[model samples]
Target chain A: MREIQVEYFAALREHAGCGRERLRTAARTPRELFAELSRRHGFPELGPLKVAVNDEFGDWEAPLADGDSVVFIPPVAGG
Target chain B: MKPFAFSAEPLQPASLRRSLADPRCGAFVSFEGWVRNHNDGREVRALEYEAYEQLGLKEGARIVQEAIERFGVDHAACVHRVGALALGDLAVWVGVSSAHRDAAFAACRYIIDEVKHRVPIWKKEHYADGDSGWVNCERCASHAQPPPARQAGR
Candidate 1:
């Protein structure tokens, strides 16, 4: 099992009901981890979503490691 | 200060513009995106912006740098506001200085457009009807490119 820190923003945050959390999980990739969390949090369907690992944009299939910080980026709308 | 940044308090465009001052540059251009009262027929009362600061700053700065390099601008900067912003408030600002007006204007437009399309910033609209939603999120889903077709055979 790997321990990871996950953060939510905007819509995900609203749906998740929290901004940050750390937990142990068996999921190995961001895609797998997100699937697990989506089941638990009832996350919205993945759209043009992006993921960040260690504060930089990352591939969804990239392997997760212990202590990795992950953030799922939702659609952005900034002027 | 970094070329791109986020401000929680009201943005001071005057100082931001002054920071790009250059004697060699005879022209300056700026763009300010303000919170408007309505969008898509909904009365927006206010807006709250949030960003993944670590990535947003990196991406935002990269965009400004690209503008300078592409347009040969003397200096350029962009500031986006976070937290709650009321109607008519400055939500984002971009400034560019260059030897000619063309470069300055082009670079200013480039920075804002790229920032909107690239940066990891999200805006939530609070509507007059006591409803709120993340702007562009719904449309984004529909417009998203379909997932790559799975291999014909696993």
Candidate 2:
């Protein structure tokens, strides 16, 4: 299993009940990983979300790497 | 000082204005986004802002640079607050200096608009009734006006 760091923000944080965690997963891509975690955590499938790998915005289909940091950005609301 | 930045401490608008001082510029424009007391009929008691700082800073600076180039502004800067904030707190600030009023005004608007749309900052509003919600997420889920990424190519 590849290890990854996942950070939650805003609503996702509340749903996941934490800001961050390290997990061992077999998911091959960010999209699959998020789907697995959302099912496990009961997170709603919300869209318009952006995925970031290693702090840089990236595609959802990007392959997962061990120790990669992933951030799923929800619809931002800063003014 | 970098043209764009974020501060967890209280923002000082006077200090920001001072840094943007340029004798050659004839117009100065600014915008301040204050935490309001209410949102969509709920009484908001406070708000907490969180950001992906590493990415937020890079995107913020890029927006500022775009403002300077697209509007022909002499200089531009923006400051956003993080952490807990009470009602009426200065949540965000943007300032632009240009040789003319038009560019300064246009650039200031551009910076604030882009910062809101592009930066990965989240705002959670704590309500007086003890409930809270992430701004845009709950509301946008059903009524999203198309994600920015999809509209970016236009």
Question: Which ranges of candidate 1 are over 4 A from the true structure?
Answer: B139-154
Clashing pairs in 2: none
iRMS, model 1 (angstroms): 6.1
By DockQ thresholds, what CAPRI class is model 1? acceptable
The 10 consecutive residues of candidate 2 chain B with the worst lDDT sum are B145-154
Give the local distance difference test score of model 2: 0.85
The TM-score that candidate 1 achieves is: 0.92
**Position B103, candidate 2: lDDT:** 94
Mind giving the per-residue lDDT tens digits that candidate 2 earns over A4-78? 999988777877899999999999877778878877887764557788889888777768999999988888889
Instruction: Quote the lDDT for B7 in model 1.
Output: 92
lDDT of each: 0.86, 0.85
Per-model C-alpha RMSD: 3.7, 3.4
The C-alpha interface RMSD of every prediction is 6.1, 4.8
